[model samples]
Target chain A: MNSSGVRSVARIVARDDGRGGTALPVLESDGPLALRRTRGSGAEARVMLVGAMSGPLGGDHFTVRARVEEGARLSVGSAAATIALPGQAKGEARYDVRLDVADHAELHWTPEQLISAKGSDLHVTTRVDLAPASRLLLREEQVLGRAGEEPGRLTSRLTVRVAERVVLDQELACGPGAPGGWDGPAVLAGHRTVGQLVVVRPEFGADPVTARVLGEGASVVPLAGPAALVTAVAPDALRLRRLLDEALTSLL
Target chain B: MSRAALLVLADGRFPAGGHAHSGGAEAAVKAGRISGAASLADFCRGRLHTAGLVAAGLAAAAALGTDPVALDRAADARTPSPALRLAARKLGRQLLRAARATWPSAELDALGREFPKGAHQPVVLGLAARAAGLGPVDAAYCAAYENVSGPATATVRLLSLDPFDATAVLARLAPEVDRVVDRAVEAARQAVDGGVDALPAASAPLLEIGAEAHAAWPVRLFAS
Candidate 1:
């Protein structure tokens, strides 16, 4: 038997509806969930993940789907980093996030970091489908382990499709024995936390508004255009968090 | 050592692993964005304008006997993506190895020892051209051709495009390639005539993003 707990929350902010911006109550669902919204105004709404329980204290799986209809402008962000505590049995968390932007619609999905405690495993997949004239700014941040703790073994995949065409496909697998793995100079560069941000705006010109967030111990690179990809890494989780926040602020 | 010798050095099949790299073409092809010969031609043309043009200009400057170390640094600054930089060095090392074997000039040998991690491909290609007794224009043209064709050919292989069609694409792009090379050669000549400090900086952002994304993939067919 599959005894699982599920929580679903959706919020929509319509700019011209003229309520000075009203917030929706957080909705909860005990099973698989979906949220869809259509708005006429250029408003933004964020969903915070708080008090959601899963399988064991550590091992778990969750599916999340969100869509923004045509002519709607939506922005989504998480309250804080979602933690996957070390599992008794190797555990995994899967997120299949899909965003659909219609003609001239704009969507920005910038979620908080994903922190995997030592010995935990996780996989997160995000698929963005954009129309011909649609625009999207999507960002994801992942930190392997807590400071002073062994970095968790994890695999993360991000696949982006535009106009029904696959544009960006990325997969990262990091552990102790993998060849040229996380510790290699090519990736992570021995850093514990890494963040990636992608912006796709076909309407924008070659040189869009993209900036790098550089801190004492971390670095952020921003790419601009019809599509842009950024990767940043820091020594620890805290520094990674700070760098990501700064990057999003500048990028958005 | 003549212009023909420089052309030989710039040949796509110089055994420098250039054949194995599509210079981001493989990634673009796998993404299904680049489908046919026409699109491939368009992609190559864009690459020529961006990555190819920049590398060619830099190589031309290096051919003027500019400081290899400074040229290497400038190339690195122009290439913001670690993956692309690493790819350039890998190709550079292979090219350097070939150059050492074919033409063991003291300068080329010295560069190998000095830049063990690999100097940028254009910088090394320029040095090799000079050591081979090729002029600045020849060196610049060779650099442009190699950078453009490396990816064009890679796309052909990755997408299984017809070789005849692919060559036809290359033939169509020949004029544009020549135009870019001519511009690069002129700039290189001006730099040499004036001073090596006139070399332009590298600045192509979209390619850099693709390089970084390609680097992070768990499994990839191309080296970079």
Candidate 2:
């Protein structure tokens, strides 16, 4: 057990090959970060992140960066949910994902839920930079603990910028050291799972979305920019995903 | 740095449009999550730390002389609910009007011109505190206290809860508010040196969700 922890960077750069196909110019992986170019169709490129090792244990720093050049369509996903575990190190684990979509490009960042195990502390930051004409569909889900267990400290920050202007920036902290009432009736309301879906389409710039509540635990609303944000919380991941997927259908 | 100025800015009767908003309490009330004074305290405590802390950060940053425009954007970032965003800006606009009349400052005038429709309320509150010759902590204290106090006042009208009990809920949460303010001021100071990224973004999911549901309601006591 290397209590020292690991630092990893897995990256993907997708571009239009100028031959009616998308090309991954760069696919790099280091340490526990593994990247694979799955089968793609037409002008789209897909990447699957395979965790070669179990971690982002405490004191580990992991980064995933994806850039979609103009005219390219990129879809990124993970094989399984990431489980944050406590290590001998003294600090929290860090996982950062940076995404950039150029004009007329598209990106789908549909990562699996991050399960925060007991005694584990992890901070996940996802920053997305998009062009006005760029299309993006990102789904983020957090499952507090495995099941029938209490969650450790987990903080997740999502910041998205469209056309160089911030569209949405928010952070949700749960578990230890978090402010009170997180699990109260007004926040999670005792829900152990929370998730959000961010949809940004060029058409939304002119034809905006009217805010509406989808369910008791979910709502769809517009952001400051040409984007729609859907937030939901449920008793479990299955229900959370079901709500998010329903919202996705309407959004798409 | 006159102590009374903090009172004036944080006053619920300041005509800044805060009274109309329940800080998501209306939705919580309808949800039956808050039935009495004890539940009311629980609700306010949640808000005081999440939204309250974020507001205090923005207010403290603004009072520290950070750009109001940037702070406004930060506020937009921190607020995910569109209804909540609109409410904050509306309150900000009203607060700006009141602050300009109370204490005129070139910074406030510039901010007014920048966000003619209004900025975020906490940003405006911070700038208003600065105009009143107060510091970042004072602004943070005002924002943090107001976050919980507004809902406390609103609950009295919504549930017909004993006015004494409502006041006591706020009184009991004073220490928590102070703790939130300390963290907020610390974040504000960090923001001054490290940028808005350093500001605390602690958020209550239910509050944001409840605000959205509340906005859709046709008949409601609070505007937000």
Candidate 3:
């Protein structure tokens, strides 16, 4: 219970009009977070998430929930990088996101990078529940610190379930001294930029090109639902971004 | 119920198919992250805290009678490497055979029937601990110990760095291993009530990445 924090919620539900068309009937949002409809082709309803607040300060708690109704499609992105700063209480910021995709629904979530400032402690968790025939693509990237400074402590966790069966669950922690040995080769290998992209579908298989895109500093892990979970880490943010672009392109 | 059963399961030569895998030490060694005993100690310590802690939590939860299928999915979520997942299921299958032959429990049989190819090795190990009447903490200790021991043994073979040095490396890690088991059992106790979400999801990114690379390797001493 950190005081002096901003609590925001973005609830979005995309509905299908039955003619292969998608509509956003519910975009109830509050606080410093807003969801704006964007242009997309076909049945895909694309939206951009804009943060009214400059960034998250220490002790800020942000919650987001988005649901795609049966046979509906929704694609989400952010307007800019999420800059996180330390708060007054614990000097930490927290983000909890929940996503649900109904039967035959599809969701594409590709957000901008998260830049953790010095002395900032951040925790982010995203949970997804997918019904049968549903699909979800989620990407999370983080830059440890601003230029010339050591990155603050951050922990990111992602949990995905298909039909109430967990398929992809991964957590990465980075800090001066934390659960993940930040300096050790077994964890980050002294890299500051870390990113993970998860794709859940019914017909997932080995993609050699995807494997090659995930080259040396990254990996492509296949989950139980024949889904693909790709993770990458690099000393440079731009380098990681290029690799992620290639990997995501292969998935397309 | 049987204190000796913990030792039996913890033994490296239990024929559980762990011998074929180096717990990522082979890759780390080849990557030059581990050249000597000190670096190997660091590698093993990191694995013990992250993957080791998470595995111990899952095993303890399974030993507490949590659903093996659910635990298997949780294990899958925690593991982000397909190659490592394959290795885990392979080890799980091998461990199931030994557990059924040794303990002969219906619970183990049900798990085998459910995951014919295999469950994650830690899930099977936890259930095997249950069938052997061991507690969650006992299972956690077994998992934590194996996490470090596997890498140490593998490093000894990979580097020819002297078996005695590797043995000393494990002895040095005994204290941390105990702490990991304690934390894992505590998490399992919470998971018994809060569900599998209460378990730890700590991970070692390089281990996952290295396993994927190692899987594509044309030749290697260990399977993962």
Candidate 4:
């Protein structure tokens, strides 16, 4: 990656604080990625990502890694959307995220939208691995382009595993150069905003979630394992978020 | 190896229970997106490259004799829709049943017993091709063709589309299906040596979303 672009990494490690609270003993940020510990309630640690600079530009590489050990709880979010912009170098940008949750641990990952601006190309991969008996609530949302603008190219993949078994894995390619009909009625259907909510609980294995359509373009379906995935596509980001939130309200 | 067996396996009327599923066309029709042949072509092209490509890769890999258990996990990884997964397994169970009766391979018998509820349809399709003395390309061809044919044929019923026009839609997609099969076969070859992770994870979100909506319909012409 003769990246005339930036290469950054952000990391967090949460552990049991031993006084009935969660502790983040390691918080690291580099280059364009910044992390800060936020105030939280009992047993859960909170962290917010603050973009330090612009241009997760084409030709850049960035990674975010988070780990929660047994008995620890962590919730991570972003201050605002992360916009991918074109860079001087003519290369696609790469964003990789790795998350691990141990047995009896919990994590809520609700990052803000990722926008792919015109002339930009970004490939993003996110993998979340959970131990048996782990609990997780992950919300992932992507907005193809800013309002009133044609998107460049964006490909995103999310893979989740429970107890080393794949629970949900999917990839979405949108914007220009993806493939014919990607924006057509069979895929995005002219919708620029898409999102998914994955909730994994131990009890769900025995009780199980009832599969149903949540709204106009949304549905919650139970996975083969102890998890339920809610997916939605909307005209814009706000509607996408609303649909996912509504599903979440009834789910959790 | 056996082109005749490949045709037999790829036949749309193979008693695999696929006639009941629209492969998302029923939902697209209900949504007014697939009112005619042109729109159906658009829907099928999208499905062929994304979900179609991924399924072809899995099918080819399984035909190459990849471990079925691991490939099943890989299929689960590629499919996020629970409704689609359920439908694939149901179709797989039906396909395996037909394969055992037709080819009678010991391998097919073992796979059937292993996944009694069903495996993913693509995985079962590949195993069936292998049982019939077919190769990876044949398996990939069957998988890719089925992906488009299911939706194409279903539209003929849902929209009362002209059967000739519907068949022409598929005829036009034959070139793209060839390209997709090449890509799928290449990926499967790589996956055979590297890992199941090497398989294509192309996804069609609306297909997943549509499958869910179709499953919930009180009265529908297709099962998915």
Per-residue accuracy of model 4 over B82-127 as CA lDDT, tens digit each: 7888889999999999998999998888898889899999999999
lDDT per prediction?
0.63, 0.90, 0.85, 0.90
Candidate with the larger TM-score of 1 and 3: 3
Model 1 clashing residue pairs (backbone): none
Two-way lDDT contest, 1 vs 4, winner? 4
Estimate, for each residue in A1-252, the C-alpha lDDT of model 4 and write its tens digit.
464677888899999999999999899998889999999878999999999988689889999999999999999999989998888877899999999999999999998999989989999999999998899999989888899999979999888999998887788888888867788778888898999999999998998888888666888888878898888999999999999999999896
- lDDT for each residue of candidate 2 in B21-123, tens digit (9 for 90 to 100): 8888899999888889988888988888889999999999999999888888888888879899999999999999999999999999999989999899999
lDDT score, candidate 1, position A228: 54
Higher-DockQ candidate among 1 and 4? 4
Ranking by lDDT: 4, 2, 3, 1
Give the backbone clash total of model 2.
2
Reference contact recovery of candidate 3 = 0.66
Mind giving the per-residue lDDT tens digits that candidate 1 earns over B130-153?
A: 878876777778877776677767
User: Each candidate's DockQ score against the native complex?
Assistant: 0.03, 0.75, 0.59, 0.73
How do the residues A1-252 of candidate 1 rate in per-residue lDDT, one tens digit apiece?
Answer: 333323233333322124433233332333323233324232554444443343212345555555555555666665456766545543354555656676666777877677767766665666777787778888777777666676655666666656755555555556542222135322343567777677777744455553332432333343212555565667776676676667666655
Point out the worst 10-residue segment of candidate 3 chain A by lDDT: A205-214
Per-residue lDDT of candidate 3, residues B1-224 (tens digit): 88888889988889898888899998888888889898888888889888999999999999999988779888888886778888999999999999999999999999999999999999999999999999888889989889989999998899998999999989998888988898899989998889998898987778888888888888888889
lDDT of 4: 0.90
